[model samples]
Target: MRDPLSKKVVTIEPSGIRKFFDIVSEMKDAISLGVGEPDFDTPWHIREEGIYSLEKGRTFYTSNSGIKELKIEICRYLNRRFGLYYDYDHEAIVTVGGSEAIDIALRAMLDPEDEVLVPQPSYVSYVPCVVLAGGKPVIIELKEEDEFKLTREGLLNAITDKTKVLVLPFPNNPTGSVMTKEDLAEIVPVLIEKDLFVISDEIYSELTYGRDHVSIAEFPGMRERTIVINGFSKSYAMTGWRLGYAVGPAAIIEQMIKIHQFAIMCAPTTSQYAAIEALKNGDGDVEIMREAYDQRRNYLVKAFHDMGLSCFEPFGAFYVFPSIKSLGMTSDEFATKLLMEEKVAVVPGTAFGSCGEGFLRISYAYSIDNLKIAVERIERFVKKHCE
Candidate 1:
């Protein structure tokens, strides 16, 4: 057979997270922590609303931009939470998930060979989406000593004439890092000076421990250039429902909606209705879940430290990235061996980026019992590997 794949497609690799997932599924009763999905179901009321919508024959596709009511709620929610507002009519579009918002944002903003500066170890999708959209991904390594946060200096260094967008993955995946408004202030002047656009992925905005999540859009001058990607997935435990939206200046959002219109007619109708419920009534649920996660965070951080793994205290999200260098194996090797030997699954830090090479991401989204079991197995695995 002739080489048939597009040149761009050939350069991509299967998600590194999926490799551990495949191995975990093959084992019996593996305590898996490789995925960032919330362990809770969509709250009962939210689920009921979706069922009611379906029963009412609200099964038709929504307007390509999404249901107006939902967008209005989104506007209210963003303004209430982060003090960032978008025009419900023109500055927002519902998408299949934050994933699609990411894709469309990249497509809408990137020209061939334009540069997208991404901080690593961030989400797996950010860089690849930039590539598929015909842009270059410039990954700036976020250091563990900085709590895995991107520093202002690194941000300044990574910028060049071709840099058009920066993917700020705060409340970040894999590392459980978050940027406070004070933390974000350091980068704002650099962004303004460089005239860069920001694609802020804030899906974990509600899960922060000490402070409320802040949007870059709250900064002066940044509002016009920042596209915020948020969803019902992490905050409302609606991951399977696949509802998300991007809010930005109408000009950029209009362009994104055009790409979204052609690629996905609309997000799931039932999910949109459910999301409206989540937005209108789900704040209590988020608080309840966040409390539970906080308990687990405290427990797991202690557990990791007791086991001789140095983990940056996770300030947000459900994951904790612990350095595995003490075990004298690569992060991938540690993750692989833990699954094989102890039936425990975690994602290698290196899966996120090269800066993550000697770390491992352990999600604490599972029940405490399951987390304890997984950590015990990991402790045993590390001791055995170390010996």
Candidate 2:
């Protein structure tokens, strides 16, 4: 029989992060600092809400856009936290996860061969999502010297006449880099000049340290052109809940909702109820978790430095991108050798993009005890290899 699978799906590479995770899962006593998932459970209040929804028999599917109450809470949370305002009725759609919002947003906007400018050393999904939507993925390699934040020169250099979208993955993954308000200001003119729409992935917005997280959508004239993607996953330790939302212009959101209606119908009913409680009463919980992550962040960065690995001090997210160049090994080789020799698993920087070649992404989401153990193992591996 002739092959029935779509060539596009076959051609897309699987997530490199998951490849290492699979290996680590089967290994005995392996400590993983690979995945960015939070080690914390959903706060008791949030979990209780979900349980309450189930106990009350709220198990039916919601409206395609989601429960109206959850949508209102999402809008209120965005405004209260980020100063972003959207019409809860027409401009917001709760999704299965931020991942679904991303996929449907791209599907709603892109035509075949439309170009999307993606900053590299970003989350692995952006490129593949664009490709799957029949859009062209144009990578703009962010520099380590600039602390992996995108610059105006790089933005201008990457944009072409066909460029239709920009994936702004900030409070970014893998590298844990964040773009400050000033940093984002520098690119507004370029985005305006190019007429580009932004898919601002702010999943880690609540995890920022040292300063408040700024959304590009908050910039003047940018709100109409930006789709703000966020969820309870990273911030509330609600990853398993699979609830997220997208906020943008009504025109764009309407189209996205159409795609979502056929594809997902609605996000989980229990999760939406849980998310309502999250938005209403989860601030203290987020603050507590954020403080914990910040402490671990400081500890891990110091540990990397003490071990002679040069690490960028990440101000956001729960991962640190430490340069592995001094050890004279490619990222994959370093990660592989460390996992095999010391039984501590970290994702190779290249799992995010080629620009991550000489780096390794070590998540700080694990507990202090687990992190301390992982650091010791990593130090031992480095000493054995670097000597």
Candidate models: Cα lDDT each: 0.91, 0.94
Question: Relative to the unseen true structure, what is the C-alpha lDDT of residue 329 in candidate 2, on a scale of 0 to 100?
Answer: 93
For each candidate, C-alpha RMSD in Å?
0.9, 0.7
Q: What are the TM-scores, per candidate, against the unseen true structure?
A: 0.99, 0.99
Q: Report how far residue 337 has shifted in candidate 2, in Å.
A: 1.1
lDDT of 2 by residue, 69-108 (tens): 9999999998998898899999999999999999999999
Candidate 2 global CA lDDT score: 0.94
Find the 10 residues in a row with the least total lDDT in model 1. 378-387
Candidate 2's C-alpha runs over 4 A off are none
Q: Give every collision pair in model 2.
A: none
Q: Write the per-residue lDDT of candidate 1 for residues 142-177, one digit (tens) a residue.
A: 998888888898998999999999999989998989
